[model samples]
Target: MSVENVMTLEKKKGFTLIELMIVLAIIAILAVVLIPKSQIFKNNSKNAGVTTNVNTVRGYLETKVTNNGGADSYLNAATLKTAIASNFSLDSSTFVPTGSSSSEQLVNPFDKTKASVAVADKSSGATNNTVDTVETSASDGADGEVVIYVCKDGYVVFGVDKGGDLTQTFKVK
Candidate 1:
């Protein structure tokens, strides 16, 4: 090739700084848009998983209670633990939420707050916790948003916060 042509080809071989910046800017914009959406999707998937876990645990409680001779009786945390240990063996005992409090919580699969207890959203007082013998989110009443918890009537029930209301559809009571 001619010297001038070879020079031109070499100069064009790599991206210019401006071109690189433009490409980066476009990628950055895409990341900005997609990152938030991706987070939303992740949170949604986590919420669904946590909801399912709560419901599954509730069902286990129901069957266990019914199968026992107690018609309306329920197991407290202590009894529930005992029953789980004695009767039902979880294949992955690691999946169980261990702590009744943040300090004692185990690895919750969907609790992105990094707490062993999962909440539908952020706040304090709702970290897989119990208050006044009632299971409450860590920040249950602080923000006027009643953070829901899988608490006991001495019996576990399933529910979620629907526009600031604790709503449940389970009819095993």
Candidate 2:
């Protein structure tokens, strides 16, 4: 082979500095664009989890009201909490059931911890789409706990976490 040809082939075997810089720049740009979006997606998923738990509590309340023979027989916050804990086989404080593993407890998605259920004040009056007020009105009033606002005609259930709060209102039918 010619010396010139050998030198040209050896030089071409390595990447240019500009090519390496361009690749790094592309990777940096992709990270800049996608990192925030990934966080948003994670938060959205946690919010959805809070929403699901609120709905589940609402459903349980509805069933309880129905089984107790209708709207006239409403459960107070303490009674409702106890009923829920017993029904779910969970402790009121930790939400983990006695003699059960952590996996069996209802977990708050945002914090990755056990979820508790509490009741809001009866006189707080019903507020729609706002969970902050409801949370403050809870009888047990703690962050990362599900709060239920019981009314004469229905129930409003909600939960708060780092991801934010989600609420669901269920009407008696």
TM-scores of the models, in the given order? 0.51, 0.71
Which runs in model 1 stand beyond 4 Å of their true positions?
A: 73-156, 160-168
User: What does candidate 2's lDDT look like per residue over 26-143, in tens digits?
Assistant: 9999999999999888877776776676677777767877888864466755666677777766776656445545543555565544555666545345454232233333334344
Taking the tens digit of each residue's C-alpha lDDT, what string does model 1 give over 1-173? 79999898878778789999999999999999998899778756655554554465556656765787552365544445445433323212322434243432223344323322222221124443332344433334221111223333324344333222333434333
For each candidate, what is the lDDT?
A: 0.43, 0.62
Candidate 2, residue 162: how far the Cα is off, in Å: 4.2
Clashes of 1: 10
Model 2 has an lDDT value of: 0.62
- The candidate that wins on lDDT is 2
Q: After superposition, how far is residue 88 of candidate 2 from its true place, in Å?
A: 3.1
Least accurate 10 contiguous residues by lDDT in model 1: 141-150
